[model samples]
Target chain A: MKFLAEINVMPQKEILDPQGKAVKIGLQNLGINQVSDARIGKHIQLQLEAGSEAEANQIVTDACKKLLANIIMEEFEFKLIQL
Target chain B: MKFLAEINVMPQKEILDPQGKAVKIGLQNLGINQVSDARIGKHIQLQLEAGSEAEANQIVTDACKKLLANIIMEEFEFKLIQL
Candidate 1:
């Protein structure tokens, strides 16, 4: 089975997102007002072949902990769709 | 219109990916070898009510340039889906 994983990695809540902040400031200059709290992060799609949904979930979980995300500074969640 | 934007923000080609490199080394330690060149990034899904695909595309492009992406360090691509 093929699975599509979407992952997001951002600074922790207590941590400041300087990149996001800078972009927010830039947006202000662009005349797009009413925008607040702009946070910047990453997204990834993984096409993986697995035996079953359970197996795919396990693989993704392991991948997140082992490779895909930095738990210290990032948080991740994924939706599995068999293709 | 609903648009699914898959974005990747990595160190420029000339820049090194220390985070990805560390993950690569860690994956080796997990005994699931044969993986090389592990690059990490971000994916975002946007549910927008647009008049048409063209308008949606324009919104996405502008969003990327103005907010969703950092042209200096990131690259982005998106797909449009009417929902």
Candidate 2:
């Protein structure tokens, strides 16, 4: 079975995102005024082959902990689609 | 028109990615040895409303510069789909 995983990695809410803040300020300069909040983050797509959905979930979990996200300063969430 | 953009942001070739290196070593430990290289990065999906393909492209470009990517250490590429 093949699975497609969409993962989002973002700085913990308590942690300051200087990059995001900088971008938000820049957006204000660009005259797009409706935006009030800007949070910057990363999105990851993973394609994995597994025997079952359970196995695929395990793989994605491992990938997230060990590779895709920084556990110290970041938090991640994912949704899996069987393809 | 609506467009779906898949954006990949990666470290510049000149930059050293300690995270990616750690992942490569960890994968080798998992007994799945076919993997020789690991590069860690981000994927972003954008849902945009536009009047035409050309306008959509411009919006994407602006978004990339202003929000979606870090031009200093990262690079991005996107594909647009009409919906």
Each candidate: fraction of true contacts kept?
0.22, 0.10
Q: What does DockQ give for each predicted structure?
A: 0.22, 0.16
Worst 10 residues of 1 chain A by lDDT: A31-40
Kindly provide the TM-score obtained by chain B of candidate 2 when compared with the true chain B: 0.92
Predicted candidate 2, C-alpha RMSD: 5.7
Model 2 bad stretches (over 4 Å): B1-83
Query: What is the C-alpha lDDT profile of model 2 across A1-83, one tens digit per residue?
Result: 77776677878879887776775576668854333444567765556677788887787778778766789998988887887
Clashing pairs in 2: A43-B43
Weakest 10 consecutive residues, lDDT, candidate 2 chain A? Answer: A31-40
lDDT digits (tens) for residues B1-83 of candidate 1:
34443444444556566776766677678854443455566544444556678876776678677777667886777776665
First chain TM-score, candidate 1: 0.90
The models' CA-based lDDT, in order, is 0.64, 0.70
Supply candidate 1's per-residue lDDT for B83: 58
* Runs with alpha carbons beyond 4 Å of true place in candidate 1: B1-29, B32-40, B43-61, B70-83
Complex DockQ, candidate 1: 0.22
Q: Largest lDDT belongs to which candidate?
A: 2
